[model samples]
Target chain A: MYSNKYVTIYTLVMTVIVSVLLALLFSGLKPIHDANEAVFKKRDILKAIEEYLPKPLDEMSDEEVLAMFEEQIEQQVLDAEGNVIEGIKADEIDLAKEEKKPVDERKYPVFIYNSDKGKLYLVAVRGNGLWDKIWGTIAFEEDFNTIAGVSFGHVGETPGLGAEITDNPAFPAQFKGKKIFEGDKYVSVSVVKGGVKDPEHQVDAITGATITSNGVTDMLKEGLEIYLPYFESQKKS
Target chain B: MSEVATKKEGLFGKKERKMLIDPLNDNNPITVQVLGICSALAVTTLVSKALVMTIAVIFVLAFANLIVSLLRKGIPKQIRMIVQLVVIATLVTVVELTLKAVDYPIWKELSVYIGLIITNCIVMGRLEAFAMANKPWQSFLDGVGNGLGYGIILILVATAREIFGKGSFMGFQIIGPSADYLIDTTTNPWFSWYMPNNVMVLPAAALFVIGIIIWIQRSRNPKLIDIS
Candidate 1:
């Protein structure tokens, strides 16, 4: 039988102790956690150009991924007007937070991978999926119209259906060699169900995941259009 | 409660052993008592996800039990539940932080479920039913037993779902189309005709697997059958 005074004291002490312990653990582990996240982002970015890497992304260690990102990838941050924004690392820009901003005010991060053949530009995109947010890094050939490769990520989507966009290699593989421009018109690749009539710009969607497939379609159209100006400016130069 | 002159039951006596072993079968947290079913259905889609959930639950449950049992005598009856929750929440946070630091990808996948562990009834249930009334060591054993009980069922359902649903185990393709499977359905004589059942991949399918488990368990152990 605890008195009111004792109960109050007990609760206070427990709360204080727990809070202190949690705060300590959180602060202590923050650096390592941040590093892990950075490595994860770098790894995903590199996955867009995985074929060009000397070793498979899976085989590469975290250090190697970071080193490869540093050595091979050039970071660029672009405004809606396609002007390069200086003084910020591309990976440091949080796309989710940027998504919350107004369209013209948001900044986009681009990762340029220097390969033996040419420079493959990787741009990050985020949009809504059936259940939650889905994002991807798209790699484009120097011409900025032909897709070199792609790697997708999702917060929450039905596994084996919508999640196949990331889980199944075949899904992302379809983007390879796909053209995003049709004679100077910026027409981002579309995820088509039933059939793909345009072999160069349309790919088959995951079966039974029509909403998520459509989400990808809409995401690519809007996400890629934002970079049309940047691509155009780079093409002229 | 007096300390009477009696035979000292060493560290792990028969009673303690029961506390550790009973939950694995007769007193299973998932199949028998039907506690923590929400997570059982959600995380069992993948063996890997279920395994991570199991480990996280075990860590939280065992530590929560130990801490609650240790403080049982000092805890006020009026605020015991809140105290228990704080303990569980702290441990769950620890699991989340550690998982993020150690494996970001798995952390990303299991993020929501890991946070939900704070609300997992089994953790609170054991604290209320067993830990508050038991010795620290015995309570710890009860926690582990229940955790393992929940884990056994979780892994079983995940294995059934993943194998039948996706033709894979722990993300390794075992049986499916001939392209990349370890056991190529096109070439493997045994599974040549076997096609993955799409129904098993759905979250609703976990309920069926759990229902079958409960049915078989009750049938085999007549004591578990409801007579009322």
Candidate 2:
């Protein structure tokens, strides 16, 4: 039987020891963890234009991914009015954090891939999925309406269903070459269930995942609409 | 000293061997004891994920058991459960941080499940039922045996799910459409009629697989059958 004093002392010592150990480990490995996360984000962004990359995203080492970002990719931060916000690297902008801010106050991150052909504009967007937040990086051709490629990511969507947006290659493949503009109006792209009637503006949705499909549609409509101003400015320049 | 020498069992003696091997079958964690099923269902959708998860659990459980057994004397009975929790939580965090630094993709895939290991009943159950009353080496073996027991079922369930559900084994397409499969179903002429069952991909299917495993295990080892 432990006396009250003994029990208190035991608990105090145990708590202190566990906290110190965890705190030391966490601080010691913080740099590596941060580096890994940075590379992961870069990989996801690059996955949008995987077809244009010199090598497959999976085959590239972390150092290679970082080097490619440093060499071939130019990043920019933009405000709601389409003006570039200087001194902030595009990769530094956390879209998840930005999503929490007021719509007008949010900053968008754009990655421009300098390929031999031309500059491909990649933009990030975040929205709600069936279970949690869903995000995607969409790349547009120089014309700014044709989708060159897209790569989606989700936090907690169901496996084999909603998560197919990221897991299945075929899902993102549907967006390739799809036009987001009808004449001059911004229609974005729709993930239509059943059959895609408008091949120009619609893609077939994932089977049995209506909410997530709709989430992607809504996310693209609202997400791409914000960047239209920036695209217009870039086209003018 | 002579009495102590006489009492000393060899390192891999009968009792120690029992501690290591019992949970593999008769007292298996998942199939018999029915612990740690939450994570079993969640991460077994992919064999790679399940394999990584099993390694993480084995590491955590073995260390947690050894530490708890070593501290069993000093851990106040009034706060034993809390002490056990603290130890398990610390081990889980360690695994999480290390995994994040070493294999970011697997860490991302197993994001929440790694953290949920702190609540895994098998870890706590062993600490309370076995570690608290056993020697350090014996408790360590017990922990490993139980983790292996849990892992066996996890990998088995994942194999069934991944193969039947996705027509893949550890991400290699084994049988499916001609475009993805290793053995082109379109031209294979043998598996052309087989389509991957989507139900097996669902989390509910893990329960059915586990149920079948439990049934098979109990049927073979009648001693494991519940009389109650």
Candidate 3:
């Protein structure tokens, strides 16, 4: 049994040594960690144009994917008023942080992927899910109204039900060719209940997942509205 | 095991090897002692998930054991528990950061559970029971054995659950799609060939599987049975 004086000294020395060791370990690992994060984000963004990639997404190595991103993708960080902010990389924008800022002050990143067929503009969106935050990248065709593809991800949702939005491909596939604007009125898109009778503006809601469905609906309406100014400017030009 | 003399066991001596092998069967951390069951149930839904969980547990348990064994002599009697906790917590954080930076998706799926590794009784149990008394190398082997012991069971249960529940093994579709077996009206679909057992996906299924394993283990090894 250690004496009280010995115990106190031992504790202090152990704590100091452990703390310093951890600090050094963390600092050394930070760059590789950050690089992994960047690659992950890039992969998610690239996933939006998965169908258009030269080879299957699964077959492509990290270097290949990064090369594709550099060669075929154009990055832009946009202000709320549709101005292109220079000097800031699109990948550096953290939507979670931007979500906390005032609407006008928030920055949005757009990834334009050039495929052999045409150009695809991918926009990032984030919102609350049933349990936590859900985010996605929705890619638009040149017309800016027709959805080319979409990729949704979530923090936590009911694994069997609400999670179908991400886990089930049919849910996202239903968005293809679904128009975002009905003759400039900006109807966005709806996650409809019962059935999606109006094919152009709605997709079938996840059964028994009303809250998550509503969350997606709200996410799309608000998330798409943020990029309207930039769309309008592009249309004018 | 107690009859073995207290002579210093060589690095891979018979006694030291028993420390590693015993936990796999007769002294399993999960089945025999019934420790760390919560994580066994939660993460074993898929073989892939269970595999990742296993690797993470192995890393944390081995390192935590080593650190505790090294500090065993100097640690105060009054603050021993706290010291073990601090060591375990530090190791868990390191595992978490490495997972986050290296494999973000699995880390995301195994999220919260990694933090809960600090609470895993197996890690703390080894620190107090074995590491505190044994040499550093022996303690390390014990940790690995227990971690692997826990992992093997987890993988078996997860494989069964995923196959029965999802009709997939590690995300690959082994069974044909449900749409092919639709035999009912548009509103309510019934399967003609086979339907995935929805119950298997729930956490409760792991309990039954674990129970069956214990039954088999005890039946084969009669010495494990206890009767009053």
**Counted clashes in each candidate structure:** 0, 0, 0
Displacement of the residue B11 alpha carbon in candidate 2, Å: 1.4
Candidate 2 deviant stretches above 4 angstroms:
B1-8, B186-188
Which residue pairs collide in model 3, if any?
none
lDDT of 1: 0.91
In lDDT terms, how accurate is model 3? Answer: 0.85
Candidate 2 lDDT, A125-219, residue by residue in tens: 88889999999999999999999999999998888899889988999999999999999999999999989999999999999899999999999
Candidate achieving the largest DockQ: 2
Residues B66-169 of candidate 2: C-alpha lDDT, one tens digit per residue: 99999988899998999999999999999999999999989998979999999999999999998898778878888898888888889999999999988899
Candidate 1 residue-wise lDDT, A1-237, digit = tens = 778999989989999999999999999999999998889888888888899989899999999998887888899999878789999989888999998899889999989989998999999888889999999999999999999999999988988889999988999999999999898787899999999999999999999999999999999999999899999899999
lDDT of 3 by residue, B1-228 (tens): 122333665578887788778888889999998999999989888899899999999999999998888878888989999999999989888888888877877887897998899999999998888889877887888899999999989999999988887677888766535342223222343434566676787789999999999999999988888821
- What is the iRMS for every candidate structure? 1.0, 0.7, 1.8
CA error at residue A230 for candidate 2, angstroms = 1.2
| Candidate 3 residue lDDT tens string, A1-237 | 668899899889888988997898899889877777777788887776788888878788778878877888899999978788999878889999998999889999999888887889999989888999988899999888998988888888876568878877778878888899888699988998998888999999987679888899899999998898898787688
| Model 3: how far residue B40 lies from native, Å | 1.5
DockQ of structure 3: 0.51
* TM-score of each predicted structure versus truth: 0.96, 0.97, 0.90
Q: State each model's TM-score restricted to chain B.
A: 0.93, 0.94, 0.89
Q: After superposition, how far is residue A146 of candidate 3 from its true place, in Å?
A: 0.6
**DockQ of candidate 1 against the true complex:** 0.78
